[model samples]
Target: MSRRRSKILVVSALAVLLLAWEGAVVLTGAQASWPFPSGIIRSGFAITADGTLLVALAGSLQRVITGFLVGALVGIPTGIAMGLLPWVNLAMRPVTESLRSIAPIAWIPLAILWLGVQGNAALFVVAYAAVFPFILNAAQAARAVDRNHLRAARALGAGPGLILRAVVVPSTLPTIFTAARIALAIAWSSIIAAELALGVKIESGGRSVAGLGQLMVATLYVKRDVNALVFGMLVIGLVSFLIDAVLRRLRDTLLPWARR
Candidate 1:
């Protein structure tokens, strides 16, 4: 199908889904138990106006950003080193392989035990989630750089630094960015889990240590507020979608030759 037709179809499907949901809610007379699409909108607006949503979003974003940066800073360089040096690869691969096989969420208990229920616990989890993909992808990408390109650059009297900048780094960038996209999603999801699992209690109603995940959990299980739960879920989905869209655009812009 054509792009325009595909988009229309998607929109149509969404509209149908929304309508079906509202119809079900009306038929069941369970507006309080299940949120209609309008309930989600109203809840979102109400929470935003009260500044509850903003605070949670900001706290979550801060942890995710910090964790992602730390993970990338550590993982990318280590991966490059491992890829470029046989000794480094031999030394690091076994440890990395062992650790990578373990799920990031599995470390949540340890993180909470080590760092307590505060922000640091969540940060640790998010960083752990973000690191492995970066390491694996960057190492593979760096290793996959054409040997002939390196030899040619060396033959032309190019230094290691020069060859790395001109050839190795450029060749590896696409894979790195791809890994980054995956890592970002992982980091985002991990932060939510961390926040829900280890969220600190705040005395203030509006100003809480709770992130969206916490809000979602509380709304559903504690408050039994389906509208609020739906709102939180929508916000999460929208933010994730936007971030992924931005990353895709950045990739396309930076790697224009990738299109060919």
Candidate 2:
């Protein structure tokens, strides 16, 4: 099938799946007090009545961006360095790989102890999540630079710095961008986990301090409010989808030459 047809089919399939899910719940007479789809829409509006949802989202986005920047700032350069220099890679590989093995959440306790389980702690986890993709892929991208190109540049009397700037960088740029996109998703998730851990002081509908994730978790435990959980899940998925789409557009624009 054509790509366009495939996409259309996928979307239709998703709609069907959603309908089936709601229908199944009703058919089984589950205890889930699922609000009608329209009610869910109203609830979304309720969440955003005075912009609390948007504010919380913005805060999370800001933290994610900052952490991603931190990771890329350190990871890209370090990855490139390691990729270019065998000695550096050999010296640091064990440490770097070892650290990557440790899950970002594992550091939560220490992060809270040192930085408090607040915005900074969340940012730290996201930054930590962002780093691995930067370093690992950048190193591989650098390594993938053709030996022929290197030889040609050297034969033309180009120095190491010039060869790197003119050849190595351009060739490896796609891989770096790819790694950045992957890291962006990781950073987003890490920030959400951070928010869940630290909790947001969101005020909504004349109420006060409605911790976004906390509220979702509360609804989840209420047992009857399964619809709320579904709604929250959809919200998160929609946000992540939009983010990934934006990054894909950026990748296409920034590196039109990026190979599939």
Candidate 3:
């Protein structure tokens, strides 16, 4: 099939599926549980028009970006150092693995106690989520660097720092970068949960920011806003898919040689 026809088919399928959901709602006359598409569009429009959705989305983005930046900065270097120095890896492996096992969500209570329930705790969740990918990817990448490359660097009188910067890091960078994309998605989700759990809002009440989690909560509380919840989920799914597509594009750009 031609590309354009394939795209049309996909869109048509999705439309049919959504309409089927609407039909189900009508046939069952279900309230609260299965609100229809028109209701979802209305809720989405209401939130968007009032700017609650934008503020929530912006706040979420800020928290996600901060955590991802901090996590990458720390995790990459630490992982590289550990990989290069056998003693470091041997000593810290158990602890690192142990902590990694702890879900970032599980840390919410502790994070709130330590950093308060607001922005700091939220950032902490996102950062912790991001760091693992960097660390795991960096460690494996470092350990797997071609032996011949290291030997050649050493023979050229390159010191440890120089070798690490010029040869080792470069060798692992592409793979580490790819893994970072996954970490970023994790970080975004973590921050959203943190914000919702903490009940964060723009300027307290008065419309309030409306994250997907927050939207879900609102649906539960507002006594039959099922449409809002489903729409919010759709928004989250679209955002995530778009992010994955962007990451794929980045991978192609950064590793053009891999394509060959």
Which lDDT tens digits does candidate 1 get at residues 1-260? 99999999999999999999989998999997778988888888988999988888988898899999988998998998888889999999999999988888788888878986667888999999899999999999989989999899999999989988999989999999998999999899889877776543322234344577666656655577788887888888888898899999998999976543
lDDT by residue (tens digit), candidate 3, 1-260: 99999999999999999899888887888845777887899888987898767776777777788899999998998788777779989987898899899999888888878986556788898899999899888888888888889999999999999998899978898878877888988987887677677653422453544455655565556535777777777887878788888878887887775443
Error of 2 at 80 (Å): 0.7
lDDT measured at residue 37 in model 3 versus the true structure, 0 to 100: 85
Clashing residue pairs found in predicted model 3: none
lDDT of each: 0.84, 0.77, 0.79
> What is every candidate's alpha-carbon RMSD to the true fold?
2.9, 4.3, 3.1
Alpha carbon lDDT of residue 169, candidate 3? 78
> Which is the leading candidate under lDDT?
1
**Cα deviation of 152 in candidate 2 (Å)?**
3.7
Candidate 2 whole-model C-alpha lDDT, 0 to 1 = 0.77
TM-scores vs. true structure, each candidate: 0.88, 0.81, 0.87
Backbone N/Cα/C clashes per model: 0, 0, 0
Arranged by TM-score with the best first, the candidates are 1, 3, 2
What is the lDDT for 243 in model 2?
Answer: 86
Q: How close is candidate 1 to the true structure, as a TM-score?
A: 0.88
TM-score pick, better of 1 and 2: 1
Residue 23 in candidate 1 has what lDDT?
Answer: 91
